[model samples]
Target: MTTYAKIIVNGSPITKSNFKLHNINGRAILPSNSGKYHDRYALYEQEIALIARNQNPDIVLEESLIAILKVYYKSEKRHPDTINITKSIFDGIEKSGLIINDAQITRIIVEEYYDKQNPRFELELFGESEYEINYSINKKSIIDNPKLYFPIKKNILKRDSDKNIDKNINSNKNTVTNKNICAICNNEIKTKDYMTADGGKTLICKKCFNKLF
Candidate 1:
């Protein structure tokens, strides 16, 4: 089952069914909100700031409940309320460990309003792709012998050999041939029988080849 995390902003909890936590350096932050994830501007800005400050991020997995609050009163128009909410959210993000420099804010507007039943909000922050988490297991305790839990050294070596062979075959296939011409220099190639140095069709002349090499 996918893990979730609880998001807390300005001492208030944000409810969400599936929570994914990201740790920027040592700081922990949330990616998605629970229920109808409406506050896009606030979340995106905060994420950007975090990415700017921290180069390496450590991810945390957990389950969380989020309560989304409306910025404006029910009777009031949404425009003013949205502005206020965005401002407040930005303020909260600034104080929530993410440091924003003098960079200009880039905003993306979502036309459709967020609905709990029919929500249409989908905005992902730009950063490095997520990686899988690997757990270190103790093999000696789990099995009668530690060797039984892991593949034999010979088997591992054989697999590596097979992989290397495949790689060599692929590299040979991709190597440039003598018949191909160089895209940069329109020179006739001397070697047409053998494979070119680049594994592409040989097109570069001796002078061009010397310059490139």
Candidate 2:
């Protein structure tokens, strides 16, 4: 809930699943083919742009950000998938000039619910530091026992894997900088309490590792 910007678009969100492809000069080209989609997308852009312009008129964010979207649907049956409906909303946010590009969004949180009388979605943006702090504070229990949220097999983190883990870490040691920085946060590793993920390709510091959990 630690958001820097928040907006609510009062309409059903559009999905990009209805895109149509065409042939131009024997080359395949895909385009959005639904007029309803365009209308809703334009509505989102206009509302976001108006709010952004009202605040600074020339504001644009290029830093890494987190987007949280809450969608309220009109019915419980045959609703669109959350993933399928994100593109148009993100594109609208991009077109609003509130941010230079949607590519700046490094994380996304989406939730859906039923709201028969008022179908709409709320969008909120958060900075990295704010999101990390808020998430850590609010989700402390989940982090403490990450295995509950992300279960692992009995043999995954056992003492038997120590030798293999050490070998992988040692082999990838040369890939890091002289300071041994964490690949995710770019912070120098000051203690031996660090580990690798993704087949030992990513070096993660203790703080970043805890955040992941």
Candidate 3:
């Protein structure tokens, strides 16, 4: 299990929902933010990028990822929604070039706590290899439908009476000799490494397919 980076950015976490509507050409359009929130949000993203680069100077993850985010508020007044903060955090990570893209993140864990003296955001990132190990270890306890992770394992479909069933299926369905790009994640993948979905109208890598459906 590899931990890619752990970054600490000091400030109150800002939700992506901090946007205001503007009346342009007699129509209301929502821009990125209002007056004060815009400057604050931009500074927040910049802080995240700078800290992430300093933490993992030479590392940029390209694999599927998991992000653990913790936000410590300065007071007990009103805590923002944890889910709403993910967008800004992910966008900041992308700006930092810590990961190839935010789309690589497959799972996230969010937590909020009160700390009157210190307000900050902590982020921890893990790659796909780590996720796989944890998934296998906690499969029974964590997931209600484990098949979603391993939809096409050979041992699950193997039969004592017929040893050629797995071979036959592989030869017929997954024996493409060319490499193709996944439609969902836009990652290059070997055709034989995965399968098509949505009635053969879309080609998705196993990781993206599993993450999606």
- What does candidate 1's lDDT look like per residue over 1-213, in tens digits? 222212222212222212222222323233223212323434655653354234323332222212233322222222222433433343433433332311212322322243333321222222113322234547574556332334435643334422112222346568533233433354334453222321222223444434432
Of the candidates numbered 1 and 2, which has the greater TM-score value? 2
The clash count of every prediction, one per candidate, is: 25, 0, 0
- Candidate order, TM-score descending: 3, 2, 1
- What's model 1's TM-score? 0.20
Q: Find the candidate with the highest TM-score and give its number.
A: 3
lDDT of 2 by residue, 36-155 (tens): 222343455556556544654555666779888899988766577777777767776777777778888888878888798999888787777666523442545444533233444585
Worst window of 10 by summed lDDT in candidate 2: 28-37
* Arranged by lDDT, best first: 3, 2, 1
Each prediction's whole-model lDDT (CA): 0.31, 0.61, 0.65
Residue 177 of model 3, lDDT score: 43
Winner on lDDT (1 vs 2): 2
Evaluated at residue 78, the lDDT of candidate 3 is: 66
